[model samples]
Target: MSIAICIAAACLGAVLLLPACALARSATAAPASGIPATGVIGIEEGQLNADYWIRQQSKPDATILDPRAIAAQNKRLHELDASVHDIEHLPARLTRAQVREWIEAMSQPREETLYDERGEEIPAATLAALGDNLALDTIPAEQATRYGMVVRRADLRTFPTRLRVFNAKGDSDIDRFQESALFPGTPVAIVHASKDGKYWFVVSPLYAAWVEKDRIAEGAKAAIFDYTRKTPYLVVTGASARTVHTPEQPGVSDVQLEMGVRVPLLADWPSDKPVNGQHHYASHVIELPYRDDQGRLQFSPALLPRAADTSADYLPLTQANLVRQGFKFFGERYGWGHSYNTRDCSGFVSEIYRSFGVQLPRNTRDQAVSPAYNRIDLAEGLSHEERLKIVKTLEVGDLIYIPGHVMMVVGHEDGWPYVIHDTTGITFRDRTGELARVHLNGVSVTPLVPLLFNREQPTVDRITSIQRIRP
Candidate 1:
């Protein structure tokens, strides 16, 4: 007879850490259903499916200017935590939470705040507040003022309209500007926006004022805001060209450029943007955008051709067994062109459906607009009843999308809807358990939302529409 194998490390460790004979009690604890012993966790395993499990070995501490360094620090913390957990099993009588506390204390390092341009660290209070699950959109006004990062040119997208630039860094005050007056695709910075949907910006140093809600993309990722703290005054010359350069050094005074395109600084240059002619000068200028080892302007394949799956069966109802098969390929680091290392959005969808013998389109937009086996035209819009009818008509394994994206609604896990899609990797987002957007580099699966599904210019926002396809 075959044995249903179970790994005892997670349970045994938990039991031994409790106390004498406490092992017996902990040993009797069966993990919640559907949760397999992943060696790191013993609880119902379904909870472990969240796209990156960040174990808080240390107590939440300060805000970091460069959060990138945390990964290196976390490695040491994990090692120390293992040692702490090793001793807790001595029958010393501790609650489970207590055991976890001690383990965390040993594993995590004390939080440290990173300093700003002035060489002073942000306040501990500010760091602690940042630790809270604060939505990017609901930032408190006081904190916004205190931590306000000033950037020159930021890209903003108005819902259902073309993306435009707003001059958030006004040459003067911002009380005199008008939203309607702001030019499309013009760069702007965030001075202030209220939860009530009212806000103000500086179109130029001389112009500033309130803009309507429809004028700004709510909670959009502010690229310029991120750069201002590090590299200030990065100017670009070619207004119509795709490639631009960055200043070599920080705090360099602006150089005279051209018009129809302000030589003004641009922020959040794409990973693939050209760097030639971009120079940085703290006091003196230095050329950059160096050639690669092969003597070519550095280039990497950011997007691949979209392919469609051509498998035979694609219905979840006909393939119910996949519900229990979690894409357990977690803890993998991200890599470009290497889907095996980290899953991209289209890569995840294509591979998963392939496993089930269902062919799917390889790119988000293509998959979203593929010859549907149903179509939901958002242009005409639909009532709740109509929407439900359309949704109800969907078969298991049928894909749902916004404009140029796709998501697979799987069987419920622990009373919540589980969706499988490609994020930076194959990650899961748990909203109401049922509805979640595929968030990768700030893009998701919600319809009517603007997405960077296609990298080509001019035709970028053209989603066309959404489609539902199944075999």
Candidate 2:
């Protein structure tokens, strides 16, 4: 069976970890009866494939934004969005109040009841303990910001502790602690340490959260920035790729590189020399960051196989490329805050656009309100018909937002728009106009019109905004 079929079958009855078997049936077999057996209610035969959407576009290959245009857009984002921090230009010193605000903003107590993995209610005292671990009292009056580089793909947590919490009991897919993830070679400004000294509150370009200290290596500011700006880098274009597994250099071995992660290439390396026991001939020698025993930054050459999905630079921002990139993550499990080595809905869209050098805020709330793009705001007063009219005009790569989730428009089929998104589940009106819920806890493609945000409202009516990554 194909990977999608396996994923779909394995995910049956799961609340938030995999796709439903209905997806498998839709991809593979037709019903024995004369009627077509599309397991998904609205998905048609060819709709599962990315090529179908690409074929529908009149100018699929046309560049929506060239590199120069993308660079301009990124510049505008930094200037407009408070969330998209310009860490490089950040001052070396920060006030205690500034650091406390950043910590309190992310460490606020949850409003909803939370449960542990064992189905036990997480008590108020436990939540208080987690808050105490923030070590806000230890912030110096005049804090010095330290620079570091992410040595590996590391999880960014809402709290310093690794305790996993969930919205519902026995549903272990979405861990509430996971805020986001930082890829290798990414620069961060280390500001505060957790009370236990195991995690650091570092601010990256797109996110600010508590990441494990060992995953970051302290280094000089110049060296860190220079490494980021190094020429002839490789941009991970696939959903994800890993370095060659090496027993010799355990730190750099088998490191996962997610889509849009750029690593500087060691172009001048000697071809005869081996990198971490592997010959350099069949691989691209790239510079990777690793934390030494003393927790300092060090760069070493590592071999990424030539066959790995990577580009010399960012892909051209075009309609076809957008559809293709979105499909690369077609069956990936939904990972909240970039957990599980996968991405959440906003992260999925962010990474897709990042592969083309487009910058986006890390979270759905921020991305929806960001002023960097051409946005069509659907106010609460707008009628469902009015929202549907806007949805019809949505082209490939347009982002549709409703509260905490976002979806990327792929194409339209018979005037009903389709979207590819990372979601836990979707409720929609089935053929009989009755509500049907499908637990699709993965990256999936589905039509837009029939989806419901809740029992009383359709997804279109809930749309807060639609952002187009164009001039």
Candidate 3:
């Protein structure tokens, strides 16, 4: 027998038992014997467990020849089941009385419908689009329905509960650590979830440590508008040279730029720079000047002002790409008299910056000493909170300095630091050489430094304080 027929028979039986009672109130505000009327009642059956049911009757059918009518009905039933599963999972400590009380406090279920393979008898909103076409041709539109299904599937995934790291060597368990040990900006991947309802993540290549899911967003696929996983860019002539839309590829091509590159930094551009200067072009390198709101390029572009708590325009600098390129340019000979024998520290900084439309001074001390840069002054010691607040405000291409040297922190991987700098006579000799003239030039940090000054690290006073001049 159909559900409607069974319900009708039961109602008739009840009415026969007490005609006066039926006349008094047909719609009761309490749970009727063997039937629930108040609050959301869950229907459990065949893979359909603990589904919430709203007080909605099925809408009248539209099309006659539609084939998916049964499928549509089944889909609606499924949705109802999903909604109640989690609600029932609430602590068992609550008694039936408390459950009743909690149910009373809940909101009513909003009515909805479901869809099937054929567009007919299906909810209109569930229709899928193929390319520019709505695919209405596949499913007859004549069968569309007004009512939609309200199923409780899953909500957005929450922060991962657990995190750990392992060595990149053979993807084994040689050197593993907890997520907390990772430095800011260090790259890591979310591993499996924990039994205690937590998430786990780790740095890749190195397989470093697992961290909370809150620290890492699921890569590219999870991104909404700009679904780019990894964006590669070059720091040419102290400005951002070219941004490749794709992730982590070596050797940036000019041909790609001619085709029109996506401006990932559009949200953070000159605003991140300290000073605002007119864009200029000289030689092969372009001297793109950072501009502030006042039309000057004298402040650090890293400190670009932004509205508090807005997610839009939260573009990121590609760290994996920088690491790959930084290593690629590793063994090239260092250039002194020549403009491009190899990259010096300042030359490297200049090249990377020029590529992005920002210009920096030629030397570290000059770049460090420039008054045009944004000033984030700190003495010797401060708490991590105080230091991080200032660092969080920094953007790409920002300068980080220690006693006598400087480096750029691009971004973070597993919350660890990555830096790029050129040291004297430490140019790339060649690829895969035991020992060439090439020695240890400093490494470039992504999203750069997390702390410039702190109360614990008094050594910071000895080093030239970092100035953010890019706008």
Candidate 4:
């Protein structure tokens, strides 16, 4: 049975259990648009793909995350990677003028307009204290840069504090300055620190933000960068995985590495060589970053058991494998800027493609309008039917861009396009024919046509573009 038909039939069964008056009212109710009432959409039987993903490893011909697919478009990918604000591609030395610029950009005190929990204005003294927390004058002058690596998944914050602030009370989410997150093993340049002597302002390949001092380890520039490009690395392809427990090396033991994180595999270690008394033969020897007693950067060896899910290399870049990889995060929570140990809309899609060695911008707007991809502009004065026509041809892994959001096309059912996206909310028609909004707050499946923008405007009427990463 079609998904819509199955859902309609299920609703019909619910009607059979309702009171007579409710049933009578339902008898004349306009049929639902066949969109699933809940955020979880069902996958059809034929959508299964364990075989393809499994075979791709043993049979190289079947792999999808092939860099060669876009090798000819290398220039485009380079441009996209360059667009990020990360320090990985920046110069090793900064002039005094540049240091001042970074300090000015990152260390300014906030304006005195603050609010209390009840949305009431806060006293001036409280605002001053908040400003005092930013020790801007402590910024250093010109210096040679030191390299660092994220030892753990760390929240990127606007300011150094763990405290959540808002323009008004009762608004706890977004945290105003929760920049993005830096996953484990992400390379960064240690540029500055907060005035309070707590947070480190480091720039990764994708973003620059204040991360907790304990979460990053500074190291030799050559050692840090070389470790990332070293051969025979294990790529963490799952949502997240950890090293096997090591009591001796608590600093690096069982550290969590998120999807697309790659760490070098210690090649050909003797069986007697062990990390924390565990024999190296049974596990992969991977180098992990950590901070020393004085809070400087250092590296250590840890063992990732053979059982932990990882790939010898990145998964190949192919549409079929995209669906399989994306589904691995099916129910992850929607975190803005990769907050709360979850990924938001753009972050979700980017991580999925990252497993296949693809790079994406940090936000929905950039990913949608990025010149690096094969984009179909919906703003070309096209009519409603014309836009729908373009949507019909959407392939698997195609990114559908509706303002403020992005969704990956898995496939279609009965001409209704289905999308897997990390989202906060979804809109669908209720049994009574009125639009209903459900807070998804996680990765979800939904049809593209019935989704409403702001629960009022049809997404179809306002779609800005449809982005396809593959040429």
Number of the top lDDT candidate: 2
Q: How accurate locally is residue 362 in candidate 1, as Cα lDDT from 0 to 100? A: 38
Give per-candidate clash totals. 37, 0, 124, 8
lDDT of 1 by residue, 181-300 (tens): 332223333334433333332222112333443333222223323322233222221111122223442212122211122112333444444333333121122122222333222111
Give model 3's TM-score versus the native structure: 0.26
**Candidate 2 structure quality by residue, lDDT tens digits, 149-186:** 99988999999988999888877777888899999999
Prediction 2 global C-alpha lDDT? 0.82
lDDT-superior candidate, 2 or 4: 2
Candidate 4: C-alpha RMSD after superposition? 7.2
Tens-place lDDT digits, model 4, residues 217-276: 888777777777888888888887889888888888878888888888877767776788
Best by TM-score: 2
> Over 4 Å off in model 3, which ranges?
1-340, 380-389, 424-439, 442-463, 469-471
TM-score of candidate 4 on Cα atoms, chains taken together:
0.82
Q: What lDDT does each candidate get?
A: 0.28, 0.82, 0.28, 0.67
Cα RMSD for candidates in order: 24.8, 5.1, 34.7, 7.2
